[model samples]
Target: METVRIRNPGMYWDIAANLHFPPNFDASKHYPAVVSNHPISSCKEQTSGNIYGAALAKAGFVVIVPDASFQGGSGGEPRWIEDPEQRVKDYRDVIDYLQSLPYVDADRIGILGICGGGGYSIKTAIIDKRIKALVSITGVNFGRLMREGFSNFDPVGALEAMAVQRSAENAGASQRIDIFLPASVEQGKAAGITDIDVLEATDYYRNRCPAEGSGTRMLFSHAAPAMAWDAFAFAETLLTQPMMVVVGDKPGGFGAYRDGMEIYGRAASKNKQMVVVEGWSHYDLYDHPVPTGVALERVVPFLVQHLGEAAVSRVTKPAA
Candidate 1:
């Protein structure tokens, strides 16, 4: 586990990230690579990023988890802006670095994204076929949330508010307006954030595994553009890479009910699978060891199988 900066040439700023090398990792021998994408408003050091990256490394792949531009420690203007296109570009930019490393097999590269990152990874894999395999765990596309808002959320009203926010923002407004998060869980619950997904995540992100630059607020002005984008709009025609989308089995009355099934079906890949962890919600898989374990059970093999035969013969030995 080491912090490394991956420079995105001609971009706003370099992505601050962590590079993980497998145990007994022989720098002499090249290894397959896994690029991880964290949830929105999260960084590489968090439970979602670190846990997944470390787990994959333990499974014998070199993993790099880069903080999205403008989020985490990465650089971009008007901080906290969640530009979907830039987020997608961030993955490709990171891959640009991975492919440069002498120890990374360019053709044997895969990606793993959790939560919102999963949504972006789907898009990234669609156009950037350099990624041989992809895994989206408890995946979410903010396009739906942005366009429609979440459960019990009003898109029309939200759009109306965003229109107002955009005017103030484009005019160089400095004050921050948060559209989703409240200052605290109690406040959020009182403010109509009763959904278990937000509630449970509030507990962890606010308490358990929070870190620097892992702030939970997005600029209100970003609402309109974020809502307009569809994360899986192109999955059917463009997403042909081997894909694995993991969703919680037991519907928690929300996203889990159909969480990633749509994207799974939309993918044009002849090789794709959906894993449903029993009795979990979308957020449950973020840090919950049980479901995370379930996700790993499938993802490890899915990645190994698709990345290349070299990884299969070398690092991914049967867990004894």
Candidate 2:
């Protein structure tokens, strides 16, 4: 395994990344590749990106886990701003970098996205046909989610927040994440946001691998573009490749799990499957041993089948 950075001189800037090479990688022999995207407001190792990336490598494909533009190690102005259009493009930009490698089989490339990245991966596959296969582990389209309901189950509230934030920006004021995202567990609980999913997120951003810049903050101006795009809007026509959607046993009544299932049902792919890790919650599927283990087990075989002979990876089961 090695860490590398790809400089995007054309626009969005630098991508900080961790690259995992398959066992006994050879300089002359080309192998299949997979690019995994992390969650929103997350870094490479903060979510399932690192876990899944390394697991894919063990299964014989070279893998990369990257931070998107304007977040984590990637360069962009007005930090932590989310751009749905450009973020989808960022997946392809990572592909551009992967295709440049001498030992990578460009035609056999696959993409994996967990949580927010999952939604973006679907959006990317809709346009960028270079993505041969798609996998979304508990993926939710924030565009659709925010457009429908963001906080207090009010979609109108989210849209209004966007307009207000943009207006504030014009007036020389910037948005702060603390307003919607509590900085502490106590804060979230006090605000009655104590669901298992949010609590998991709080614990995640507050403790494990937190120093890597994983948190729940973003520029409110990021909402406008999100309000405009739909990750699965064209899946019935454009998303024709093999795809997999994995979620845990329980969705915890959060709309994300249901949204993920909807994405699966809406995909146009003749070859698609949804694997559920029984008895696990949404966050359990993120990084916990049992669920992540089940997810990778299903993901490797899916990639191996669709990515063709080059992706017939063989090493061992994913690490817990």
Candidate 3:
């Protein structure tokens, strides 16, 4: 794997990405490629690049795991803002970069997104016909999650608070940031957080996996765009590409399980599948060997079926 910087044409920022090539990759031959989007507030070096990207490369696909703009090593102002629109646009920018390489087969490109990245991937596929296949692993629909998932905060009230914060920032106030996950499992327990996903998130972000430039916070003002955006908006008609949605059995406040089921039912694609890993929770799919392995086992074949496999790929089609 090699680190590369891709220029985002729409936003004029450099997206830092880790490009993974299949073993004994041949530049003389074109190969199928996959763009893997890391979870929000996280960087490529975490589960997306270090795990999924590397695994997909080993399975014979060129994989690029990119840190979303405004976070990690990517360039953007007022860093760590989770703008859903910009996130969707960044996928296209990554695809543009992939198309520029001679060894990449532009027509066979696929997208894999996890957590918040999964939601953005759905949104990106709706409008970008260039994306031939879509994979969402434990994906959350951020807008819905913000609106209905939280137990304490009123969604409208939260939006109103965000509006005020944005105004304050415009009037020379310091940028207000919001914590993405609890600092520790103990803190989460004290806060009455009983959701398995939240507890696992704290452990995952704080202990199990941590990477430089990956933070536990995001710009509080990011709520404005994120609250209004629907990752599955118009997916029934626009998302016709061959798709696959994977999620764990444990349902949590984030709504990834619900979102995955909804997308699978609503997608227009005649060729689509959904997989539920029985014993795992949402975070378990991130890096845990068993759940992650199950996901890759299913996803790699689906991708191979849609986007023609590389010369080195030995993955077979799923049983009908």
Candidate 4:
């Protein structure tokens, strides 16, 4: 396991990235690399990104995990701001850095995005032809989520609400955001898990993965409205690359996972696959070992088959 710091020349954000290679990495071999995107409000240290990187490294593929802009050690003003356009650019920026490396197979690059990062990854693949393959894990269609509340798809109403929130934010007023967990576990029970999957989500954010460096309480006042905009307008037309969508069977009612499958099904690329792990909940795909292994098993082979053997060696080799 090796950590590398990369500066995004285009965005001017200094990104902290981790690269995991197999025990026998050879400088002479050019390896295929998979760039893994972290979930919303998550840094590279989170279970979803690092666990996947470790799995891919063991599978003989170079895995690059980057801290999303405005989160963790990555640079950005107005911390926790979520901009669809900028997020997609961040993905491209990571690709640019990867392609510049001597050990990377430029043509065999792949991407894997978990949770909110999944949506950004899909959007990036649409515009960037350099991405040869994609994998979205329990991803969200952030655009739709912002425009419509969970279990409802009222574009007009959602946008109207966003407009109100944006107005307050622009007026220098603090905006209210969903608090997935309360200050105490007792309060969490009363809040009800309907708005959130308590068993999976609450446990991790509150007890498991709290923001420490900047402190995890990061929430965006303006970015919530930006999500209401249609980030996937070109989803059907732009993405022609091979894709894999993974989801948990339990608590699968979350609209984003279904939307991901719909997006993949409609993609211009003919090669695509969808997998659902039985009894797994949405957050289970992140920190828990069960869903993590299930996800890696599918993801590793997908990249190997698409990116080929030369690219795999780079991940397995030790750095010089």
TM-score of each: 0.90, 0.90, 0.94, 0.85
Runs in model 4 lying further than 4 Å from the true structure: 150-180, 195-199, 211-220, 252-254, 310-320
lDDT of 1 by residue, 74-112 (tens): 877778888788889889999999998878888899988
Report the C-alpha lDDT of model 4 over 49-71, residue by residue, as the tens digit: 56787788778777788887776
Q: Point to the candidate with the largest TM-score.
A: 3
Worst 10 residues of 2 by lDDT: 308-317
Candidate 2 local lDDT, 51-119, one digit each (tens): 788788888888888887887877787788777788887788889999998778878899999888899
Show pairs that collide, candidate 1: 146-227, 147-227
* Local lDDT at 175 for model 2: 61
Q: In model 2, which runs have C-alpha deviations exceeding 4 angstroms?
A: 151-157, 178-180, 309-320
Clash number for model 3?
A: 0
Models, CA RMSD each: 5.0, 5.6, 5.1, 4.3
Q: Using lDDT as the measure, name the better of candidate 1 and candidate 2.
A: 1
- Residue pairs in candidate 2 whose N, alpha carbon or C atoms collide under 3 angstroms: none
What are the lDDT scores of the predictions, listed in order?
0.80, 0.79, 0.87, 0.73
